[model samples]
Target chain A: MTESPRVVGRRTDVSGPGLAGAVTDLVADCAPEMDDVLVVPDCHYAFHPSTGMVTNPDVVEALVEALASTTDVTLALPDSQWVEDAPSMLGYDALADRTGVETLALGEADTVERTVRIDDERHTVTVPKPLDEQAVVAVPTLRADPDLAAAMVTVAEAATGSRERSDVVAASAVVDPEFVLLDGTYTFTGAPHKGRFLVAGTDAPAVDRAVAPVAGLKPKAVDYLRPFGVGREAIEGLHAEDLAAELPHEQTDPNGGEQPAVMGAGYRLYAKMTGDLVPPQFSGGSDD
Target chain B: MSDLRVGLLGAGNIGTVHLQSTRGIDGASVVAAADVVPDNRARAEKQGVPRTYEDYTDLLAEEDLDAAIVALPPFLHAEATVAAAEAGCHVFVEKPFARTVEEGQRMLDAAEANDVSLGVDHTIRYQPEVQTLKEQYDAGRIGHVPLASIARINNGPFAAPPARQPVSGWMLDPDATGGGALMDLGVHLFDVLEHFFGELTVEYAHVDASMDLPYEDSALVVVSTEAGTQATVSAGFFQWETPPEITGYFRLEGVADTLRSEDHLPKQFMAHAAKSALENVSKRARGQEPAYFKPTYYYQAHYRALKDFLDAVAAGEEPPVNGAAGLRMVEHVQTAYEMAEGTRAAANAGANVEVTDD
Candidate 1:
């Protein structure tokens, strides 16, 4: 017998009290039985939240406090490609102190392999052993990673030490997170702008699909998410407001189209006037 | 005179800077380059280096170089410098000289044994503002300077905005880099301090790491020179909002007046550059050779230091900032670390225990 798919829980507030209350409400509604929960936020690097590159730490703190009610929460992040210094570099150390949430470098953690299906093919996926077996929550920012969007599914895949797009897709299924806390406190398309809202759901695929509109994308267009059996329906949410109305949904020119060209030219002229080396954009690549 | 042919070792961030600085010099040419990373080697090639190698040893062996810039990581500085000295080439090494004072001594020994000139890129002293400050202090512009303080802090060797790429892990590793902000930045301050004052004795130190990263990301060093001048040196890795957003100040408090390096800075960097270009053009038109200096004064320190080393190599003279000076900086850093370690140990020993003179 198949269990009924869980509904989504959302809250829209900019204040600290509002965010913490919203996250607590969402966690309580989605998975009340959660114990020993692992929070995987989009902490790719130590970029400021204004970049829309990483999840705001405020969102992570709210989730930690929310999870602390029924479970022990640990903030887990995958190691960076260059080195294992992502924790301090990303400013998670400060968050840990403020929230009292223990931090884990998932890359340094041991892995365990599990079988999962991807596009009708069974693949062996290795995930951090401690995290794989525990209840996980992915708190991702509202940002379009060029064509693909970074949300729960991407955050789940990042908990493992995999780089392949297909592997990330497969790993997302293996972790099988209990909830996705979509931190739309700020959203990134071409640039970051405050899109204050949060989307929470247990169904990773469904949550990703439902939030796709917030970034002005059809769920069907996200390539890695295509193979999953997720649907585009907001079954249930704490905040019954229309999220699409609140979303700016201004899509970026993925090619870096005209804006970069204009900026590059301006900088070149500035360099010439100053007798400075015609900055790299005008000089072109060293190879060129 | 023939050009001073040079080989570049390690085409990473600072290595790339050295490659650019070496290129800007009139009688210096980078003939060969080496780096473990393929991308770095490719970048070096693009910077007009004709030949590239995956290993620095290969570059040193194959290239008939008059001198080599040891721009590899702090860990490799000793091995690479020794190899260059053994190859009958002068060596200009990037700082913190070495991971330890002992390692720095070994590199110095190698240079002396081979009779090759050794120069450390202690570029802080070469900065125009720093030089101006020093000139003013020496000329009694700030009469009988009694107190001085130097601080250089930035969110570097790691930070966003300015960083086009991710920083390598080795920079954060205590074993690889010796120490964090203290070793990375303290040595530069020490060089500049010693340049203004005579010899310095490390009085006390305190180091703090924001996380459990094996080493301190921030440091505070109290030092005094033999000439009765006391100074405080503060350095950190987590101090700025962007690249080159450094909080560096060298202030001399004298009986007669107060002098600051910030006061001597070019009012507007671009305007100064434009004025310098115009002056150079005017001089060239009058059949006078234009004044020669680094293209960008911001990085002119690195260029000047390297150019001085090449000049010394060409003249068969000693480098102004020789191996001994590099070793002195390392020794100062070593003393500071030892003092910090002693403080930590004392604190730990005092924990959970009470002492009373009964």
Candidate 2:
């Protein structure tokens, strides 16, 4: 039998203070050298940290602070904009200003196309040039996304070209990170709700396997996690606490399939009927 | 008494809305549409347009249009309007009117020289809740209003995850848009404010960009028509709007009572959608096309604006929102830009900026 992945996590508030000590229990388990590390936060677009739609810059700040104090690890936040300038708009510029760290705009940065095979077909994706030398860390917002673990794992793939789900999965295998940290500070279960859970581990799928139940999803239930063979009884060492039974489970879909499934038929019908250009954030009804 | 043959210049998002709105207009038919994007043109063709053009100039030259809806970008507005007017077609252009006052004036000059009607789509005041607020306030249901603020926020030219397309090239370009959210959205609020209180003056202004884009994503400007009354126009592109929920804050406060946009807004989108869908089915069965955008009042406002303009044109009367109104709104936004720059300069020179002039 293959050894289970060690996954550890903490339940903490939005407070940045002592976050390093709080998260240390899990970081030490990864046993990383913390040298020349590049941090990729799941801030693909410009969303406020408060919305829990993106990674909290405050939490990233604390993580950087703790790393600088204890280790000689050189850290950089490098990313390309998916919709808008994520670093500047998502408060990472302010994070850099406060911490004297720099954000590398990957769009302007030199890139090389990497090929990876997924579903027995080779797909090409562009990644930053510096991935060879840098130890990587991924900070993704924990939510009930369809490809939750895999999306977080391949957050830095194909900035300039077609970035479909297959390209993302194929790219995750190429730029495998040393550690994965999920910010459940406010989890988006169909929409945002306060999950207040921070999950961490070295193996992305394994961590997802262990923490899936906490977020109201089973490991086998996740298609990405299932492929990794990271299902129930997969974890060798784990510490998990979540609002699973209390908070939104699987998705924010308590209505059970009545609502439009995220840009589904209901949205398309509304857009066609109304001639609306802008996509609705949540499609049910007007609050008024 | 024949239907007006119309040509749609841009078949993108708003252009498509205008195209759809034409179905409901009494005597306007969108016969031809033009857009650089094949997808956009295809979308318009799917909406029953018989002909399509890659360049709007081709459409203006080839099609016998009575009126042209210049739904192109801000940079192309003056040129398209001028060409359409020169072609002896009345022009109904989307807002920000033109990139600058000069461009607006140039378009106005061309229209006058060609003897063509010019209409600007400023749909904010047409919103039911805003109209209701104005009606109630004028009736003294809310006594003498001391202060007011109108805000319109949306995620401009951008979307959250699951969106795979590239961001719009011209939206973030200062040269193309003339300004950012301030120009795109503030034009609507400026028009709305003038509808309530005539002859307003800018007191102070500020524009901010959270992203590294060329223009500001958020803008706040203070204005007043009378000596004591304070009104602000807060417009931004930093907001996430779901359908049925246009993120806005329309408030008018009087000595006697307070008026909020929500109090007057259309409610329960899903319920309304179901009702409208059912009604549309019946209307379709009756051998008449049903209204498509009846579910949302904001979208319906877009229809009303076009309908009002077409109705006025058909009567050979001056459109209610004419070239001059669009130019005035453009001038207001330009003043706000200048004032924002001046205010920032004053603050940088070690002088404290006051909140209000009076």
DockQ of every candidate structure: 0.14, 0.19
Provide the global lDDT of candidate 1 against the true structure.
0.74
lDDT of 2 by residue, B9-123 (tens): 9998788778878877878899999999998877777667899999999998899988999888899999999999999998999998999999999999999999989999999
Residue A214, model 2, lDDT = 61
Score chain B of candidate 2 by TM-score: 0.93
Calculate each model's fnat, 2 decimals: 0.08, 0.11
Candidate 1, residues A117-159: lDDT per residue as tens digits?
7767888877788767888888887776455455544554465
For model 1, residues B73-137, the per-residue Cα lDDT tens digits are: 89999999999999988999999888998898998889889888899999889888899888888
Q: Positional deviation of A193 in candidate 2, in angstroms?
A: 4.7
lDDT of every predicted structure (CA atoms): 0.74, 0.72
Best by lDDT: 1
The residue-level lDDT of candidate 2 at A217 comes to 66
* Tens digit of per-residue lDDT, candidate 2, span A1-288: 966655666666776554556556556656366676776776655555555656777667766665565554433445544555556666777778788865566556677778877667787777776554466677777655434532334454423333355644555665666777777677655455666667777766666677676656677776544446654633333334325655554343333223356544555565545444222222223221
In model 1, which runs have C-alpha deviations exceeding 4 angstroms? Answer: A1-31, A35-37, A46-76, A88-135, A140-177, A180-284, B24-27, B39-51, B161-164, B240-245, B267-295, B349-358
